[model samples]
Target: MQTTQIAPSNLGVTHPLDMLTPQEISAARQLLVEAGLVGATTRFPRLLPVEPTRELLAGYVDGDDDYDRSVLVTLLDTATGEAAEAVVSVTRGEVADYRVLPNGEHPYGQPQYLFEEYERAQQIAKADPRWQAAMRRRGITDTTHTYLSPLAPGFFPYEGETGRRMIRSLTFHRNFEGDNAWAHPVEGLICHIDLTAGTVTRVEDDYAETEPVPVPLQTRHYTPEHVGPARTSLKPLEITQPEGPSFKVEGTHVEWENWKLRVGFNAQDGLVLNQVSFRDGDEDRLVLHRASVPEMVVPYGDISNTRFWISYFDAGEYLLGKNANSLKLGCDCLGVIKYFDAFVADDDGRPVKIPNAVCMHEEDYGILWKHTEFGEAPQVRRSRRLVLSYFATIGNYDYGFFWYFYLDGSIQMEAKATGIVYTGATFPGQPNRHAPEIAPGVIAPVHQHIFCARLDVAIDGDANSVQEQNVRGIPMGPDNPHGNAFTWNRTPLTRELEAVRDANPETGRSWFVINPNRKNYVGEPTGYQLIPMPGPRLMAQEGSSAWKRAQFATHHFWATRYDPAERFPAGDYPNQHAGGGIGEWVQANRSLENEDIVLWHSFGPTHIPRTEDWPVMPVDYSGFWFKPHGFLDENPAMDLPDWSSYQGVPGTDVDDAGCCRH
Candidate 1:
């Protein structure tokens, strides 16, 4: 390849050395001499007078002494008329071979053979079309190129002594960390500035690789396209409150709000059963007189009216026959309704009884004479009281509820619990290494860890909660309809084609190919569908925007539950089948290592960081709250000492080694 030269005026016009003071010029000259540029015989005209005889004798004796000297070329800012540091490079041409030294000093020991090889590579690179394209894309249009040339000891060069020169390429470009700095390894034979015209010269290369290098890039914005029709519309419900009656059963208080009876079975139970109704205002609605159950176990089996019974004492009649003594006579028969009130009137403007036919069990007397019939039974009970308490409360800001049941037969009671919904974060992964194609000069990487959230619940009671149950959706293997499979080289969908298209747009196109062994979490089917969107385009349409769109749906539901051990172990439910104890909450009280939870939260869907979310985050409280839940005994007497009331006695300290004494 032929070498292009930028004249002296172009070299020093924006060069720094031209603006240096007289003393600085002297120092720079001395530096150049030390750097093997000027010869020892070259006298400083201002410092000493040169003898013509001596100069002539020296020149004749060592005519080629300065043939291999170095030179310093300064670079200056075009806007400022001040001295800037001079950049130096070396170019050596011998016979048919040529070499160019880089602008900066080589930290590695210079190898002559390697330097020659670099020069040859530069020649090839300058003629490479691919390299030119790369440089153009990098926005490097102008090159104020410089090189080192040998200088003679005399005032002027003699005939045919125009010295050998070497071209070294150098330019100012941004560094790896985005800071402006001089780029290194200026061996490439790029075209430089034309001195007189102050314009960059161009070079053409035909012998380059035909294939372009592959570069991966991510879009700053993504627009999602719908793949299928809308699944369902969300419906809103009104909040319902509890009501009816006032009673104290166990440690819970029950009251009537509207037509419904509100009851509290226990403080820990919050409030149970939002609404309870009664047929008559005077009759009691299932009250529990006593209850005592063992810890960690739910009571089962029928408990009707054995030792427990509701009586109509006001009507002077036994509403439910009392059986405080029978073991085999279980309360299982309590479900049988003996009589129902009838609104009827008779003769003389006075109310009279028009009883309905009663039904009763009969034993067969003989096979031939066996018969059954409806007969009238006397009206014994008028009204009765049913016993049970129900109420609920919001705890730790999470929607949770506790239930207590006092049966009509056994002395044991049962408690049931449940919790709201939540999702957990994924495990950390490796860093991304892909680089952008269009902007190779600008570097960015793919980041992992997205779409994650958490909830915390608190339990304030005697028993601890255990994770006895777990429910996961489909395994979401590489073939699953979710986009996660398509992203990681996963194969085609295993589900129905319509469902797949509706759920995952990344794989909606039949032409899209992926690997067959990628895995992901295929959560339960949410009422959503993915859709196809436009691919990235190199140019914007006329009167159109220039943003690329994404290709998938981004919505789903997550939840958790808590219940009795027997009812737990249920399949496909959030935290279902998990055994329960007293006052348990879900997703609360994270481990000690999470002390920074309130300080730093992981980034969400948006990868960009803003200045507002800093230092510590806002409050994130969750779980159930208990009202009138016995934190302590109701009215216990105590002259409690107030620790906060104490004040320090000024100048009253005793010996430092001893305990505090008056």
Candidate 2:
């Protein structure tokens, strides 16, 4: 049932999980077992998708789960018995076929690996004397040696076949105030485990004169001498949808006014939107085929073996969505909200529910349109947007992502980075000044959260082209003219390298993905403009670990020809990738003129911690957007209703206004 109104009821909450459920997960495992695909010498079976396909869900209906018509499964056969990822198909509870895939095949989604680290940590803590002592120093006994997910040890050719060897740099949790794990850090310890042999290969217990510092969450901790006790006296706020919600929900499909989008989840990419389009007067026009953060590289400034060698590809190395914290009303979001649940599997191939993994709602966005003449009352209308958002708790940091669809045919994308940072221990009262110390004897390393989103742009039709718009001032030449005049030098970016450019500080350059076939009333082509908010690009030097692998991040904008095989800028297996992703793709310099194209936009923050950011950091934000460029005849937001009628001033009655009393 579609419950548009805001009511706290299971009927309103539960929806069929869009991804593969536990039954299907079990089925995949069993199919491999029946085919004798499992043996002692083989690697653990991992079920995954064969191809990157964005199929629109069969129209959502009441009492029905959003069932996918067919399933294409890929199994990573890492066992010595078989090393290639095998492809299998299943339709309506029946196994179809099996085929050995080709090289560069990283189809199986890696979600269950992170969970395996917890058990591995407990086992190492009990077996290794150093790990035991490190835990002991923090009062962590055998009963509670819970471990934080370690940094993914990136693969190098020297470390051949790292798929069998899982290296996790461990941290201890100081869960306080009912917060999830990652409140504290048992710094300066890293554990490398051989997953194939199921043994701890090595443990890093010491670093250059630094000890394992343990910092606890103490947001409410205070001195009794001059402080009030912990209190909660705030009034309750509720958003009751008396007339149901304006947005009609039919499973994963959400329809409100002119906007229509299909939402889904990936173990790595988290909230994904497909077939995003808006009604342009009579017909629907395509904006983007698929949109999600495919690669997120968080590189810490500290370069120690335990910290320096770590560069996190959160979306790939760690499934960011798998780390999502279940959201709650009044805390995560408010207003008439509709929730969507995400489904993924645990290490045992059992399905787990990430409830309320994505939230959708309409919010008042202040003024949509407002205008007034001199000494005249203004006419104004409130603006509103349909917001779809989700968050991921990636160990020490929590990142909130949002996609906002405004009434005026503009889309704004934003990411908010919060939560505590991973730390290293120091001598009490002798913290290093270069690295910001979160607590006594703790160093919170400075880092950059660089995220790249893959955008498949289809404006009006597939034959769309991209143009770079640079505003240049006119040179004062003949005719004795001054150099005050400027014109937009719009040039067609016809190839991959031509599209690789930076946001000009002089002109604030923007790229417009336009359709030459479609024109507005004034004969100008219809298009959407991509404008990036100010944020520092990747600052790592050339040949540096951070720079070499994530070279896609050096530029804030990119345009590539649409190829099904090319989805992520940082490649599929980025764990120890030696720069073979976007850099290789663009270096080919493929033709980009008048063909299907994908827009890759990257935006993020470089965090240098301060005293105010300790305990928990206030949310830091960065974003970009798609604005209409010669696409419409007039401002679409001009349709907003006149609000002078509801102007609550005391001058409604003209006769009495002449002598009105206070």
Candidate 3:
């Protein structure tokens, strides 16, 4: 007879078999055995000292001769009660030429062994099919017409015996402010050359003693009368007739969205101070706020430095468009301006009919604009503007000076400026060698060193409404024809791996051998030479099996470049402080079959403050020197001996023996 049974929910019964699956239970037991959790034990030799007497440190500093300081630190290994390796730190002591050597030490010198090995490898690489294929991928081919006509027409011989007259005109504009406020005279001068003589003649400033400046030839000319009426009248758009000292004035705020902005102004002496700021903000922030212009408290000279001018036109909608924004349409207008001065006729010259008038616009917030009439004169007046924009977040502002002149008659804007301070890289030995190795045969030149740099950026107004334009030199090709390039890729990991294997069969292998001591490999493209070993495939496995599998032994160490300054002088310009002063150990050499992996184990960037590191960072250092072992049948005939059998002389003690006692 069958009996029905009901499970009890509150029963306090548990079974060990219910805890794990059969496979999981087996794994647990194996882990315990591997960990020696039951009875795993290690024994040490009696004759050898577990630790050394004292630790030592050593390093070199790069800086001015008097200021650069190398430091070393030592510590006792607490485990074995002996001195381990000494820590080393190097600091720049004085400010001097970083390239000059102080103590007659050539840090960038090439070792003879490295050079010879590199040469031998280069020969082998010459016959490598893979290397040849990479070179072929980098070659360029032309598919378009090779020649094109020049823009300007050439001059022909005149029919008559009349000589061609070359006329050149130069115009100088000067604004003067009284001595009580500003001291120096700022001058803005422009020279135009008319080259009917086959080539454009240089314009010489005989009176001025300064550097020679290049002014391109103009092809087109515009006149004020041709430019049409002013976009906005000189009179105030709206004026508040105040009844008392405190009165509100209505103003219009014009937001310039995604515009290239620049500012500058002519000094009383004609000198122009200009700056440029790129607009990177949302539409809401671009709105120009209408506010009464702040009254100038001091004379023009006293407040000139605070004043600025701004002018911007959409490059795509204005300059590049067939029917673009023009002075006649009044669509092209200066965004802001601080001051305006009327043109006056000189006493020596006839009544100068100054038809051209300048316009000034000030949007609320911190923006100003100035617009000048563009047309033909006796000569073209070189108009230059300066713009200044500050980034609030990055705490840095760009000062841009724009020079606009008629080139072949069309207006061209030229930008000339420099960036501010930031952090840089620090490379211990050679700077160039620090750059990444992209190609097989290309070695980063030896003279290069690493540096740290910081970037300070600021965008005004709505951060979202900014526009990006005018980018150059990006690589977009197979094999990346450009040596150093990056690409945006959208692919699944499995697909990417599949594509890699499809493209390069050799790259699909479980392990690849590299000789860091040699610069390149010279040989035909062939399969990797596998080193025979007795072990489960560690390099090919995915888990603890790989950890248990061993092909050869390896070691590592750590070193540091001591930097004294807490902060860079110019903040962080280009994200220069990312890694600080630490560098990782690059692989030295590797061989599979002969158990020939010579690894330099090293430490990474970690902040562990010791007693000597207090007040300031003291020297910290670590290194690894390989003790090669023999694995060949000819034992003694092998280049390396059995380092495991090495023993110290009587009474001599060695520290760090635990690191190598296997």
* Winner by lDDT: 2
> Per-residue lDDT of 1-662 in model 2, one digit per residue for the tens?
42222221222222333454555555555665677764544432233433334432234444553333223343443222133343433323335565553333332123224465556655754576766666666666643535556566654433433434455656655443344344355666677765545556766776424444545544322235325665578664444344556798887877888888878776667888877888877887778777887778887777555677667888766667777767753246655567777766554444578878888877778988777889998778888899999999877788999999998899999999998766655556765644676666556777888989888888876788999888877778763287667787889999999899778768978989999998988998899999987577887777886787887789988898888778668775565455567878988888787888999988899888776775567899988899877777777777666645644433221111122111
What TM-score against the true fold does each predicted structure earn? 0.13, 0.82, 0.14
lDDT of 1 at 364: 15
The lDDT for every candidate, in the order shown, is: 0.20, 0.67, 0.18
Please list the Cα RMSD from the true structure of every candidate, rounded to 1 decimal place: 41.4, 8.3, 38.2
Candidates in descending lDDT order: 2, 1, 3
Flag regions of model 3 displaced more than 4 Å.
1-154, 159-162, 166-339, 342-356, 362-662
Give the alpha carbon lDDT tens digit for every residue of 598-632 in model 3: 11111111222222221122222211111111111
Model 2 gets an lDDT of 0.67
Best by TM-score: 2
- Sum up the clashes in candidate 3: 89
Off by over 4 Å in 2: 1-27, 38-84, 92-114, 133-149, 156-164, 171-187, 205-241, 328-330, 428-434, 475-480, 643-662
